[model samples]
Target: MVRNPGRRAALVDAAVEVLARDGARGLTFRAVDGAAGVPNGTASNYFVSRDDLLAQVAGQIHQRVAPDPEEVAAVMAAPPSRALVVELVEWINRRVAGDRTGYLAMLELRLEATRRPELQKELTRTIRAARDDDLRFHRESGLPGDATAVRLMYLAMTGLMLEQLTLPGVVPAEETQGLISALVDRAIGPEGAA
Candidate 1:
């Protein structure tokens, strides 16, 4: 395998675009090479196989959609409250929305996982670990919610994002922020407890 980190990262990113635009079946090494604007065999050099490329792309999408640390720090500077939770959820929604292609690529991975058991296991572990991290962060950050609240909020927000991204017209743009606020409030309760 190639040891060039920059080239590997580029290939992974290009694979993400191909996955997002063409779904799993279309995620060929040639497609990634063309998308990366590199030589035809460049992706093949970096990735051992199609599964390897898919795995790399999966990891890259998470990084691409992760929250900005600076933004998290700024938000944390405020006192923890239901309002803060609402703000955090809104930020998450915005982050995912901002990277439309990355999120779409992630969704494609989920669909692909249905046909590949190894990929399914990998995705399950990765997603569950991320959820656990979110739960820990919410508790430690003094955010207004317990684990259950956090879980509910996550589910609600995920559904909302799916509808918003996959079918834009389903949720009116004007109502998204308000809906996010409502999701936080309901999940955390009036007193911001579980």
Candidate 2:
């Protein structure tokens, strides 16, 4: 494969855009090259195959959608409480909503993974690791929830984001914040629990 990190990253990012806009079937080396504005065969040089490109895109989307360390630190500065958990969950929702393309690409990857065992395994590992990290952080940060609460929050937020991104009108924009607060309250317990 190509040893140039910057070029490889650019190609993978282009692939993300293609995947988000055109779905997995439209994600081809030429499409990525066109999206990246590189030579026609440039993507093939960077990725051994379409699956490799998909795997790299999966990793990139995770990084793109990950929480900023500074933002996490700022949130952590607050005393742990159910209210803080609600704030954290809302922040997460906002972050994902802001990166619509990346999240859409991630959704594409999930759909494509069903047909490819390797891709499925890779995504499973990637997502599970992220979930494990969230569980660890929730415990260490003294967040107002247990592992079960965190897990439930993940499920609820995933569903909420899916609906909001793919079918925005279903949730009604004005009610999103209220729903997020309720999700946190129900999953983590009452505001005064911790």
lDDT for each candidate structure: 0.88, 0.91
- Model 2's C-alpha root-mean-square deviation from the true structure amounts to 1.1
Worst 10 residues of 1 by lDDT: 185-194
lDDT of 2 by residue, 3-87 (tens): 9999998998899999999999999999999999998999999889898889889888899889889988998898988888888
The best candidate by TM-score is 2
| lDDT by residue (tens digit), candidate 1, 11-34 | 899999999999999999999999
**Model 2: lowest-lDDT 10 consecutive positions:** 185-194
Q: Which parts of model 2 have CA positions greater than 4 angstroms off?
A: none
Model 1 lDDT, residue 163, Cα: 87
**Which residue pairs of candidate 2 clash?**
none
| lDDT agreement of model 1 with the native | 0.88
Best by lDDT: 2
